[model samples]
Target: MNIPEYLTSGILESYVLGAVSDEERREVECLSSIYPEIRQELDRLSAALEDYALSYSALPPIGLKEQIMAKLDFGTEAPPVETETPVVALPADSGPTYKITWIAAASLGLLVLIFSFFLLSQLRQAQRISATLRDSNETLQTEIQRQRDIRQRSEDLLAMLRQPEVRIIRLKGNDKAPTGEMMVYWHPHSRQVMVEIMNMPPLPANQQYQLWSLVNGQPVDAGVFDVTDAPQKMGRVIAQADAFAVTIEKRGGSPAPTLSSLVMMTPVTS
Candidate 1:
């Protein structure tokens, strides 16, 4: 808007030399379109610089000029390009605009290439991680199946120990109970034992069910169990048991079954 300050800013020099950047050139173009004074100053400065360049131009050697003029006159075809910048044909040099556009386009293309490469690499990595997780899930499933098979076999062996072919002994609850009863599972082939108690009263905290094997009419301690609604069987039970009896003994059972405290008596069928 101010002619003096705009002229003093050296933009006129840059425009005349075609050295202005694209952004600067666009700004100058807008100012020239809107303000007549800025355009007047640019034209005046450009003419002065053009005249100074022409002032340094010297005449060609005498006959060389005549020979060039004679050839120009004789040729009827198009004239050849004589200079890099043709002052009469162009108002401002357009070469730099093409160069800047090419640079910007190449920069955009390189950025797109890099972004596509990065996205593709991430996709491949994600696929690999998913595959690894899938393999881990498969391994866990296989291990679970194996553990289930082992547990099923153990349950089958326990069921066989309670089979009817194995001997059984029924014991009726005595003074401690009026109508309660208990049963023992005995296998002569394996010499393993399990016991089940039904309708028995709860034992005192420090007391438990003690099973005794009667050998030669003397009580040999089989082991101890805790009977509630369900049966509680001792582990690795039979040594050499003939008949079985029950008593209320202290926890962990006495070394021998207490005679006076006997509850039920039942002989082994085998």
Candidate 2:
């Protein structure tokens, strides 16, 4: 297993923050048990988060206990009973009972208040961790999709090259770009055309490379394309071409080839 890659994947952080799904949580537990490095990192992240939460904790104001107790309305003592006989005096210890009860009530309220503060701090920390995990997941997904696209393009090019009916045409450089080179894959029966860029100079803004197919000495538009490493499908060749050419044109291309901007061309071989 690639231990370093796994460590930097952000899963460990999510697990430590209690934000992972059940399956992921189990995976982390299983890995941590087997790998000491994972276990150590997990411990470190957990301790760091705890310390962060504590750093933001706010202490209650002084005399808060006394203030809460003062606001509590302990019910008034009962009035002395009206009796025909002599009334007995109450015990001294019994006089302190109400005071003890009020003190207990105040302590319980203070405990609840402190617990609420701790819970709020924990919730905020979880939110920040969740945002970080979300961004990491998005970036990972984009990279994965990009790799898939490149693989698919390569497979397609290989399949096209293997077709018996497909003809390979190499267009070499002209005076405008002596080092420019590109390839065209043309299927006569299907009239499909694909271009692969080998080497070309960068174009200015609002300009693109346009392919032209010469049929009976007349220029026919094959399509506009950008210079890229991957083979790109272009407009179909409607008829058999005597030659293939490339020229610089406006971004969307023009109806007719720009003769002065012609950069590459090659005659078709039987």
Candidate 3:
């Protein structure tokens, strides 16, 4: 239920005035226990009533006790009454004490309300920042994985080239491009070959570089690949070749190397 609204309604005032029905008094009592604000309001009303009572509090008029005693004559010769010490009752608490207590409680409630709102705002902002950081962390993890794969491939290629059985073949450019150069790492025993574009000229958009292995004087298509900062492992050469060459052909590469587009070639040494 909307406790604040119910507290603000006239029910509390009626409860304070002792004018509410029994059902309403029970409801108020129940709510007061359930809601601190309701309880605080109830205390405030009680404090106000105490203050009102204190405002009109005074000593009884002088000699009024004698008038009450004279009215009750002791049958014109009743036995003499025994005298005893009269005791006066004092209130356990003063009006101002209740007032101070209520004021302190109300102030505390206000402070609690303000602090709660500030804390809630901070929590929401923290959640937003956390979400953003989580997304960034995921993106960074993906990029790190991609780099790791690249590094692993580079390592594998280096390990292959370092094998004692592998032969390094340098292919020099022909008259079409004198400065273009490339290298091939070939393991004759395993027929494994890795291609590295050292200083090859950039090809047109619709063309790509293709490797060819010459076996028995016939050109065999090795594979087609792009030039990157790292060496690329091409398809394994199925047969021992006497020479290897590079040519620029259509993007997907031709089934046969175009002799006219040949850029560089190197004959196997051993």
Candidate 2 lDDT over residue span 130-179, tens digit each: 98899999999998987887677778778878888788999888888988
Question: Model 3, 1-270: lDDT tens per residue?
Answer: 987557545677667767689999999999899889999989997786566555444444566455554554443433444674454444333233234444555555545544544565466668768888999999999989878867876897788877778888999999998998888888877778887778877877899999998988899888887876668788646457899988889998899888899988889987
The residue pairs that clash in candidate 1, if any, are none
Candidate 3 similarity to native, TM-score: 0.47
> Please, what is the whole-model Cα lDDT of each candidate in the order they appear?
0.69, 0.79, 0.76
Mark the 10 consecutive residues where model 1 has the least summed lDDT.
89-98
Q: Write the per-residue lDDT of candidate 1 for residues 1-270, one digit (tens) a residue.
A: 567657556665566656679999998889888888888978886776555445444434456544544544533444556764543432222233334444555555545544544555466667768888999999999989867755664565468565766777788987767676887777766667667776677788999888888776888777788754344455655656668898889998888777788888877654
- Higher-ranked by TM-score: 1 or 3: 3
Residue 57 of model 3, lDDT score: 46
Superposition error at 72 for model 2 (Å): 20
